[model samples]
Target: MLVFAFQISRSGKSTYLQQVCLVVILAQIGCYVPARFATIRVVDRIFTRMGTMDNLESNSSTFMTEMRETAFIMQNVTNRSLIVMDELGRATSSSDGLAMAWSCCEYLLSLKAYTVFATHMDSLAELAT
Candidate 1:
């Protein structure tokens, strides 16, 4: 199932993602996840080991760094993989960023991967229809 969560910062959006990621990882490893009587079934390998770009002191432009990380994810993701992408393509111009974001979503759709993409780009919701 594709789930879209929209909320302001400091409203537990990131916390929610962290919880979900933890549960999925635990489930993948055959560990018990306490879910308040709800069963969480994870059927694929979780890829949550990726590092954030926030601490990296890269000489490359922000857009370039974003694209590099994005490309890495695209190369490694599978149909059953769960991807959590936060604020994708945010470093470029609005038009370029939106286009890149739209294209990335399109490619992810083609793969049928379960993705949780958090973004301020409201137009991206239109891609689902």
Candidate 2:
């Protein structure tokens, strides 16, 4: 599920992603969810990536930190993983970010993991098709 909330739209994309991941987690643990209906898949791991954050101590910029986290996710994820990522390429040039995000989206899709990506970049939504 790729959500395109649009840049600076602030349509609660992050919140929606969080809720979905939470619901999946709750259902996975055999806990009663508040929803009327749910079909939770068997997930071995739940990975979430948020917006940019500078690794100042390590002398890394915000974009570099974001890339590092994304790299870690790509390397570690499996088909049984549930990946809820938000704004993977937010702190760089629009073209660069879009390109990187697009590639990341493709790679994630190829892995066949249950993924929910929330992005402000509208172009990334094309992956939904």
Candidate 3:
């Protein structure tokens, strides 16, 4: 369910969103069925903000890791769960990123599953407007 909305700056909005999601997940501890039984998806794009240099010796770029993680989430997400996504297109070109983000949003909404997608893409906000 879409809960409350606040009017802080963009940074604060993002932070609060993360915190709220965390709290909700925590609050669900005793209430939800076994996690494996629940079918919610959390889709955060890896490497959306920080670089993926932790495995430099293994030669895994942030972009590749991000793509892999996104693909994995999309593939594994169940229909009965919530999705929490971060910046969806931060690793690609602006236009490409926006397109991917838009399409993902459409897909999630199509599923009628609870989703919380966080993005720096202003165009997405336009969709809500």
Candidate 4:
């Protein structure tokens, strides 16, 4: 499943992504998830931050950090992985960011992985078509 969720900050977009991540992690660990009924198969998963890299040392600019993390995900993610990316390419100019974001989306699609991307960039919706 490839899903794109578009919403403003604090409008539950991040919350929703976090919830999905939590559920998937719990399922992978053989723990109980709070969902009423979920049949999630065990799968590897990854999440990309909206602005910062968590727990990683990086003196680079935010855009560079974001790209680095993205490259990591692209390199490691597999067809069975579930990827949840929040606000991809947000640290750069709109044109450059959108182009990179679009390219990433295309690459992920080609991998046939399940992906959930949350973004404020409406232009990215075109990828669905």
Candidate 4 error regions (>4 Å): 53-57
lDDT (tens digit, per residue) of candidate 1 on 97-120: 889878878888898888877767
Better of 2 and 3 by TM-score: 2
lDDT of each: 0.72, 0.81, 0.57, 0.83
- The estimated TM-scores of all candidates read 0.79, 0.88, 0.65, 0.87
The candidates, ranked best first by TM-score, are 2, 4, 1, 3
- Per-residue C-alpha lDDT of model 4 across residues 86-116, encoded as one tens digit per residue: 8888888998888988998899899888888
Most lDDT-accurate candidate: 4
C-alpha RMSD between model 3 and the true structure: 7.0
Model 2 steric clash pairs: none
Model 3, span 1-129: residue lDDT tens? 212232434566567556656655654554553346444344332111222333576676666766676676566555555566666667779998889778766766666546666666767765554
lDDT of 3: 0.57
lDDT, model 2? 0.81
Alpha-carbon shift of residue 54 in model 1 (angstroms): 6.6
Q: What is candidate 1's TM-score against the reference?
A: 0.79
